[model samples]
Target: MTSSYGLTRLVLTDFRNYGSAQLTCDVRPVILTGPNGAGKTNILEAISFLSPGRGLRRAKLSEVTRNNEESKKPEKEQNSSLSWAWGIASTLSTPQGSWDIGTGLEIQEGKERRIVKIGGEILKSQTLLRDYVHVLWVTPQMDRLFQEGAATRRRFLDRLVYGLDSMHVTRVTRYEHYMRERSRLLKYGGADRHWFDALEARMSAEGVAISAARRQFIDHLLQAKAWTLGTFPQAELALAGQIESWLGAYSALETEEKFREVLKASRQQDRESGGVACGPHRSDFTVTYREKNRAAAFCSTGEQKALLISIVFAAARLQNLQGAGVPLMLLDEIVAHFDERRRAALFEEILSLKMQAWMTGTDIGLFTSFNNKVQYFRVENAMVHEKSVLIKM
Candidate 1:
């Protein structure tokens, strides 16, 4: 029993393309199939909000609210139809019982804010979601992950890190805020040396903490049995950064001081470049295809996707083994490009892990093998209907 609990119900209101949709599921992988642009991915994005961050798209709070275009008459009717306070609520069931969880927008002092609630009680911040569930995802847009910017890769790794360290996001947010403040001051008002010292010190402390958590996560990942020899490539992981390297050789305090000095001395240089010289923000998450001894970016397109899946699987395995609980997987258009052999292998791995993954696609045939293994659903115009008999492609 790799997973003992799962999201059994999901309700959407004025979110994305759905006017109102409700789906009830069990402890099984969920497959959502429909034509393109029929709101397949929208369902995954809604489930993502149940966890943390800005869902998968990283869209702003106001952006996810629905805008009704069907109402052509009476402009006021259209305005009334559009609900700015969109919501996502669901029931998470486990061996013990079920917990009520949900999140939505609220207007406080005329400013929109995201709210998270569990068991009918609102949380102070989103970071606390870690205690209840851990969410990890892979989207078709990430097919070119290795070839793209480091920011995307950082986000992928941070989502994995959140399973182990709830405060990682907070630390990252604070560190970036201080770094931005320092940059603005350096360019416009670095005359206050005391302020500079304070910001740099805070950045150094938070940056070092963030880097340390990543290092520990990588170590724990390797130590765990996530590399449970399967069809997926056994990818090697490494952190590439000046700060990450320094932490390897020096103490935490010593490394923080070194980073602080780097920031202090790079003030003029940073101002000219409009970016810090070196920090976790600029660090890279590196992966290698152990079988081919080639970096992920250099591997074939298919191989790159395989490497990403390998990392996600390893993280899920490691999290469960460490008592952190198995994470729910969100795979959007995951099987379209995978070959039959690989596809079968991927499904086997998911079943073995007993992971309750939510997967979406445009073809019903792509998921025939999952006929009995998953809870099937077909999406039509923002509505979802569970299928008892899945027609073969």
Candidate 2:
């Protein structure tokens, strides 16, 4: 079976620095070399859009469109093409099959909306894209993940969980929607008790489900041998959220009941604070360097980066071992600091998993170690050109 999976074709228009761009590739690992400001990361960001949420940069949709005179024109003065200020069309492949993912911006209901088409049929919801494509990415922005806020760590964990279970996205979306509505009702004081009860019930249900997935994902990661048999250091993971802790002693139903009471009791506090205090939203994911027995926050920058790579490798391994679709890896500027041992390990993992990973770095020498195992590309002026690879050895 051809386990390699990822975009075989990608087209971008009016996105970031590129006015028009496209690339086609096979299932081999891809290496893009370019100087700073050459739009190397932009290509990775384009791939990230194939999945849910904002791209790796978390940039606003407006920020992604190329800034040109046409983009600034008045609505009536704009042409049909103007509505698509930014767009990404691509074909993503897994071992199971290939999918045609046509997604981009469109003007609907007097507002900008992202629309998706699979094989020329418009999808009712973007959530359906999850079933066909799974994307995982690491960028320089996430280099400080351990030092960053809890929200960042939570999102990182959720992305890993999403690959295994497609419904995880829907559960999270419903949980966040209810959380916001409940917060609004508490703040504005207009909703009825029945509405409050209904919203809390839904949130508790979804929150419990989210926590359960995270718990199971962590267990799989702990057991995955990738973390133990790699050049990267082993990372110890833990959840410091109330719901996660409650799962140890209380059953799922009991935890949901407990959460409902907590939400009811916290209404006044949440209202005054303008935020929910105790749901999965408040959960914090913590990491430790298992060998050193030190928190990730205390680790050196290089060590922190290694720990992240270790975790991602382990997650990919688990997905393949359990028969979940292998995720496409979009690593931006990842190998600049990698030592020889670590670099070789990363290459071995990618080849072993048969994952179509798109990796970027400024220096091509950092990647010559792969020799003939990878395809090389040169990125310049918002475009990618295929290049011949010359093995160093």
Candidate 3:
């Protein structure tokens, strides 16, 4: 039931540091090796956009566009002109067939808007890309997730949930929107009770859905019986918050009702606090090493990294088991932390999964074992060139 689809071709236009680049390769692991700031990670970020959300970096639309280079033209001409926008295009090969997918920024009325197209047809929403391809990523920024505040962990958990449940994003977005509106009303004072009640009801429904989706995704990962990699340790995950704690005591409908009541009762306190104090918004994602039973935040940095990688690998296996399709994996500077033996084991597991994995590294020797098996590329000065010969292997 694993997905046979992978990105067969990728083209970037004015994306990040890349002015124009195109890559054509098989569905094998793609190894990108170059010095830092060579735009290797930027390439992975572009591929991540094929899915949903603001991408791995969580970068803004304006930040993703190529910077406008200083033009020698007159100042008046420069004032009237706009720089070229960015775009990403890829050919996806699925079990059923192959399709062309493209996403880019378009200027409409002096504002840049993201646009998506599938098989030459424009899509109204970026969520539609999920139907064609699912993506999962591990970035260097996420290495310290456990030590960060609850908000970072919550976002990480939500992304894990979103990978399996596409609709989860919609529910989370609606809940956040209503929460903001409720906060504004509270801050301004003289809010109507009826209006407050309506907002609370909608927020409660969406909050319940968000919590349920997170629980379901975690449950599925825990229930999966996939073989664990010898180099990676399993992680025990749990959620902590007022709403998450109540989930066990009440049904979803009951939870929604109870949540609504709680919101109503806390309106005065919320008004004083300038925001809603109790709901899914305050939830936290907690993880521990299964073998040692030690909290992830207390584990050694290396151990914590292993735990995170294990969770992502297990999640991928669960997705394959559920016939949800294998997702493209974006591993940014992930190999530099592992020794030769662990790196080999990681490569073996990736091969077994049969999904296209894009890995980045500064040293080519680190990826010598994958010399002929992977499609090797050297990135320099925002330019990407495929290497035909093995480098010292």
Candidate 4:
């Protein structure tokens, strides 16, 4: 049961536009189609929240509540008792045995909390859910990927890593908190040289380790580029980062010390600018087209879209090879750019990987080829309903 728990069931109560939503899929790809603003992306965002961090919305918990009560009146007269809830089931494996870990999300006016229970016993920390489910996603927001800052790409990279390695989250979280503390102290005038020194030392060590994990993840992803391109016929992926170039030259400990020393030396400059001078947080990826041998940023909009799909498929292949349980994929308005040939190939690759995916588009014809292999649903007004088509394929 644990082996095939990618998305067994999802229960939503007063969540977003839906008063109640009960969805079940036994680990197969799913296609969600509907007109624009039909709540297609909302389904994916709900699935994303089942994992660590914010959902695909990157929203605060309080922001996810539905306005059923609020919409009944003017914004100024609405009360703050509005709350929303959702339940997700995942598989958690331990040395002792494999068990089901179900989680719930509850949110009200300014507070959001996650509740977890394994098989039956209520557990502390939604982190326990991390043990069972690992999630990765790509949305329309990522369409202008290369044009964006490093933080977006770094976050995309981390999500990929998190799907493959759970511990990466712990490492990343710790590194971030450490950096925040160091930044706060640096902002204060009373901070001593030794205090800053020790904090930087810790940040340096964690930062290098975090960077290494990211690079290694990219290396694994690169290994699948050929196979990925052969199947998708779109774009190529190449990791670009100063730290990636520096990985083999030094050990982790040595890298940490070097980073600490560099930060110490750059303190005055960073303080003056109110920003960290250098760290893995500044790292980013470079996407390109293989046939044209050109960067994605310079490519046509259509070409960029194709390149992104190719990269996503490549990552999916890597996930399968890594035995990272079947990944739940989300694509928001990605198929509109693809020609028929590329669309068919996309379906083929997703089917071969045996992944559970959710894709959206306004044109139902875009997913007609998915018959016999994909579950099709039409989304409208926050209601996702299965569509039975009579078209002959």
Q: Across residues 212-267, which tens digit of lDDT does each residue of candidate 2 receive?
A: 89988998888766475466899899888999999989999999999999988888
What is the TM-score of each predicted model, taking all chains together? 0.91, 0.95, 0.91, 0.85
Per-model C-alpha lDDT, please?
Answer: 0.85, 0.85, 0.84, 0.71
List runs of model 2 lying over 4 Å from the truth: 69-82, 108-110
Compared with the true structure, what per-residue lDDT tens digits does model 4 show for residues 1-393? 123435656666555676667665555677788887887888888778777777887886655656576334355434546543545555533334556665566545745677677788876666555666666677778777778887877787787787777788878887888778877777786778888888888888878888888877777776655355434544555556555556668877777777888889988887777778778877776667777889878887777777777766677677777766556778888878787888888877777777677788888788878775776778888776877665577
> Over the stretch 317-343, how does candidate 3's per-residue lDDT look in tens digits?
787787776689998988888877778
Overall local distance difference test of candidate 3: 0.84
Give candidate 2's error at residue 340 in angstroms. 0.6
By TM-score, the better pick of 2 and 3 is 2
lDDT of 1 by residue, 1-393 (tens): 435678999999888888789999898989998888888899889888888788888898888887787522355543553333688999987767888899998755556788899999999988777778778889888888898999888888989998777788788778889988988887888458888998899999999999999999999988785785357788888999988999999999999999999989998899999889889999999999998999999999888888888889888878777777778899999888788877888888888888899888888788788668788898988889988874554
Ranking of predictions according to TM-score: 2, 3, 1, 4
Cα error of candidate 1 at position 47, Å: 1.0
Task: Output the number of the TM-score-best candidate.
Answer: 2
Those runs of model 3 whose alpha carbons end farther than 4 Å from true positions after fitting are 1-3, 68-84, 188-191, 391-393
List runs of model 1 lying over 4 Å from the truth: 70-83, 108-110, 187-191, 390-393
Q: Any idea what lDDT model 4 has? A: 0.71
